[model samples]
Target: MDFFDKAGVMAIGSRLRMLSEQLTEEATKIYDLYDVGLKPKWFPVFYLLSHDESKSITQIATEIGHSHPSVSKIVKEMIKEGILSEHKDKIDGRKNNIRLTPKGKEIAIQIEDQYLDVRNAVEEILNQSTYNMWNALQEFEFLLEQKPLLKRVKALKKNREAQHVQIIPYAPKYKTHFKELNEAWITQHFKMEDTDHKSLDHPEDYILDKGGEILVALYNETPVGVCALIKMDHPEYDFELAKMAVAPEAKGKGIGWILGQATLEKAKSLGAKTVYLESNTVLKPAIHLYHKLGFEKVVGYPTPYERCNIQMAKTL
Candidate 1:
């Protein structure tokens, strides 16, 4: 019924295991025909031992990507077959080094030519398939090295949770929250100037009265962050993303991201074609968040605040 095929990506592990078993069985038959006593599972450890004779079990396990217990089992089997021997390191009494025996070395020499032939045969078999299996496998391994699948999966889960934050339009009841959030951030890092005071004192007069919009992010109905899209009197359709702040307690929960996205969305809905932001490089996390939100460093923008030395903008 080809359950593995029906399961598709969900059955990848099981399908790979089946594939490995089939290949190992075929290789075992080939080894029997050639009178080679080596098993497919032992090849990795044996190959490493042949090249570097005194590697510790930990070293072999790390190089082969096998667990310590798995490598220990293979080592025990090889020791029983007289293919390997173990000894304590001369300087480090706690370290045990595995070495290939004289018989193992002799067998390696005998199979040297057959190893190349078998490799060529495998390559030919892979080439007969529709896809380039070797290149695909190499790319897959490289991607895993770059970012492990577990890390990627965890990040996806975190992002999903972050998306749970709700962005709500500013209301009179949340007015104090908007002011306090921005005031806390600004006073902590940089002193508030007259322009900041004007906006914080009366957001409705300075922001909304001038065709601007403010969006607040709430986690469990508690306001955690706020951002304002102030309509700019410029030649291009422009809006400044200002007065953005996430509470200290909610800093790492991606509330800043939620507020930034909501602000941009509000800007776009207002027929804005460009979005600009002013900040200081010292606010590294804020600067990083801006960049992630598609903001790019730009020059020749006037700033009303003394602390703003960095200007970034995005074409909506």
Candidate 2:
């Protein structure tokens, strides 16, 4: 309690673990009272085998959402207690199949009454509460599965650092940095196509002079990212958000996002209503960021760059 008082909400993990252990201890005691001779931990394997399911350790672990070593330990304990036994699997000689022993089957039948009693008791407990603990746990688990705590913390840290970053209009001084950042990412992940060279080599003539705009992200006065709002000469789109890249040293600092957003705003200021982009699927983070910027994938758009396999567009 003192540790929790000091730790506050950060003690959530420890709190959950403590609750799990407390529940498991209660379940163990209940099983002992029933004299079913079944361990609480063995219930998963026991219940499956009770239903006449002969499964390998892997299969049992998978169905029960546990690791193989965990299931193996329970199986071993049950075997020693003469409640379970195993024989070579018919289809797989390398694997052993586990099933309830005659002793185990008798115990399974005896435990049915206890199972019903426990379920009813738990349901009564739930009825007394405002929220269903089972549903709450599943929802919490799904949230974690969608985005783990680690990623959440990392994103927070990155967001804080990005707050110090300033998105600025590209100048002649940042012309070299603009090319280098884009080159670094492109060459590392893909071969630089001719179109890439034409733009990176001469952004002024290739991008800027064509009524397009370039933007740079300055983090503590250092150029770390660049993006271009290329004025599309086509009728379908007004601007192409292209040549976006963040320096490797500045990765996870959110510079790319800021730079891209700035370029989009710049395009909007220039009377552009729709923006387009092309990318390869292998660049998953880039693709995700594009989607985050409200860009939806579109097909039937031709490209001069051979590396372009996917096209996206957004209406401002």
Candidate 3:
């Protein structure tokens, strides 16, 4: 590949000067045909208004990255030429809004055809491939005006950190910790015959095939709660949510709500339209939390599992 020398770069720049002069000459001819003088800078403002009917001058200036005063001056001239009009802001008494007048709309509509003509003329003169590359460069310049990638990453991290209770992607290693927490909850809150049902616990780790996950809540390194999603066999049912138990030590911290939200988000991500959950009548607080998160009563599907006591479904 041949590198562009300093003189070659200047030569290209000098050619662009001649090209811009030719474009302006051709543009003036078209304006005479349309009976209006259209400035190049006005094209952006016209296109913006055409796309979205109403916007404030401040919004326009911010979007196009021009000084508000400069935008105001150009808008004023366009208004005087009967190309645009101003209106008082209804929502806010302090601000003024701008929109294209009928004449402005007509000219803006013509700009589409005029721009095509200008593009074709340049393409014909500069060869088709060179024109395509030059057009791509212009687009790249426009994209450069957007917020940088680093700023977007910083914002995402900030949003993630502020969450009240996090539902991180589940790991298999927390099964024993979760079992311990459930056993403690049963012993402390409700008197059960046996809190040691190994078969009833941790079925997710040994589940069949796809779409199974567990969310465990932690309070200073101690696992406080566990929730699991079991992929359903029937297409109509999508997935079943089960084993939602919080530690007795970690009760009343709204961890259940967080678990519910996490479970729903997971179900949605897996393309599940409906999520069914089962709860025991003894856990009235859990039922209430389910209701708050938009669950509805449904006929309980017969299941041998001890955790599938009462049934509810949340449609995504």
**Which candidate achieves the best TM-score against the true structure?**
2
Instruction: Write down the lDDT of every candidate, Cα atoms only.
Output: 0.89, 0.89, 0.72
- Tens digits of per-residue lDDT, candidate 2, 130-201, equal 999889989989999999999999999998998889988888988899888888888898888889899999
Model 2 misplacement above 4 A: 22-36, 51-59, 87-97, 109-162, 190-202, 232-237, 274-284, 291-316
Compared with the true structure, what per-residue lDDT tens digits does model 3 show for residues 37-66?
A: 677667678778888888999999999888
lDDT of 1 by residue, 186-282 (tens): 9898898999999989999999999999888888778888999888998853899999988898876777877888789888888889998899999
Best by lDDT: 2
Indicate the TM-score of model 2.
0.72
Clashing pairs in 3: none
Candidate 3 wrong stretches, greater than 4 Å: 1-164, 186-205, 208-210, 305-309
- TM-score per candidate, in order? 0.59, 0.72, 0.43
Q: Which structure is stronger by lDDT: 2 or 3? A: 2
lDDT score for residue 158 of model 2: 90
**Model 3 TM-score relative to the real fold:** 0.43
